[model samples]
Target: MSKSDNLNLPIYDNRGKPLELAYHVTYTLRLKNGYILALKPGEHIVRMPNLLATDVKRRA
Candidate 1:
């Protein structure tokens, strides 16, 4: 996928509200699955393949 394709993913706020624009994107990381993770002032947004699935496992 291209950079422009990555930008097509929908962004959401911390409260789960869809956002039209994401300003001051402090950091961006590309996930192994080709999704982009974007972080702003108050929250981090990522486009996952399964929104309802819990992908992260905590290590103790």
Candidate 2:
């Protein structure tokens, strides 16, 4: 996976990998107990941190 903001996102597994649209990343994951387990470098489906949200653009 290329190094980018997507690297920070979490995923469900580290096998097939998944993708995050906003962050433009990919990762593999497995859902467990309403939580995601396992992770891959390119994945970015996980919720971002509050601190990271600082960059989010506000709606008009």
**Evaluated with TM-score, which candidate comes out highest?**
1
Give the alpha carbon lDDT tens digit for every residue of 1-60 in model 2: 877554344333433233343355444555643334555576444553332233233212
Looking at candidate 1, the ten consecutive residues that score lowest on lDDT are: 51-60
TM-score of 2: 0.24
Error of 1 at 36 (Å): 6.7
Worst ten in a row by lDDT for model 2: 51-60
Q: What is the lDDT of candidate 2?
A: 0.42
How many pairs in model 1 have backbone atoms within 3 A of each other, for residues 3 or more apart or on separate chains, i.e. clashes?
A: 0
**Backbone clashes, candidate 2:** 11
For model 1, how does the per-residue alpha-carbon lDDT over 1-60 read when each residue is reduced to its tens digit? 646533555444443444455455454433333233444565554444442233243112
Backbone collisions counted per model: 0, 11
- Which sections of candidate 2 miss by over 4 Å? 1-22, 41-60
